[model samples]
Target: MALHFRTLLAAAFLLVPATFAVAQDNEPDVDCDNAMTQMDMNICAHRDYETADTELNAVYKKAMDAAREMDVQAKDMGEHYVGAVNALKRAQRAWIGYRDGQCELAGFAARGGSMEPMLVSGCLADLTRKRTAELKTVYESEN
Candidate 1:
């Protein structure tokens, strides 16, 4: 009886590690991929937004340069033209207003909850990425 009990105890100890390994394997990935808590989700969402915003800024600079070039060409042509730079500035301002308002509306889907921030930030990131692509299309089309 004592030998049988000892055998069972040793088997149980060995199986415990295997069980834990399987459980861990089934778990979510690290960092944002494993963001199970609301706080972590919010943080990941904000980080995503920040990355998108940075990309947008870079593309916006290139777009602004392109617009300025267009303005110069129009001026050299001696034709009255709506300034490309000015128009781009106006459009960007309007887009910013729209993005903010639209994100706020998205947050209302989770209103007053911990997930509100995540929803808003996710929306912001998505919109910013789309806007970045649009800017690239407009300014870097030749490339």
Candidate 2:
């Protein structure tokens, strides 16, 4: 039993990075290949890239609003408020890249599937939900 557990853990450890690498290898190419027409393809690619951009912007705005609220709670909290807001902004930007990359990867999965648009949309929704949770954490921590 002990050996079986150890083997399983080792296998999981090794598989994690390999899975990540395979996912990374698949994302951009999948998005690139899914376009049925040149225009539609370009649009699909743009939409995939923009998903993160839009989510990041929304997170930034939410963070800023939270910071402002915090500022109103205590005047001397400016520096801390600003710092949290800035951190959230930076995180948001990074999240945008993460979201886009993940979505691109998901797009690859959709390539051979019949419901590509639905798959892509689901990916975007999941990413958005994640970003919202991140923003909420930042907001709650500052308060």
| Candidate with maximal lDDT | 1
For model 1, what is the error of residue 122's alpha carbon versus the real structure, in angstroms, after optimal superposition?
0.4
**The candidate that achieves the highest TM-score relative to the unseen native structure:** 1
User: Across residues 1-143, which tens digit of lDDT does each residue of candidate 2 receive?
Assistant: 99999999999999999999998566544344556654455456456546754776676677788867666665575554445455556776787788778876887875856556556666876777677766767577865
> Which regions of candidate 2 fall more than 4 Å away from where they truly are?
1-60, 68-82, 112-114, 141-143
Task: Give the alpha carbon lDDT tens digit for every residue of 84-113 in model 1.
Answer: 898889889999999999999999999999
Pairs that clash in candidate 2: 27-105
How many backbone clashes can be found in candidate 2?
A: 1
CA lDDT, candidate 2, residue 95: 78
Against the hidden reference, what TM-scores do the models get?
A: 0.76, 0.46
Candidates' lDDT values, in order?
0.90, 0.68
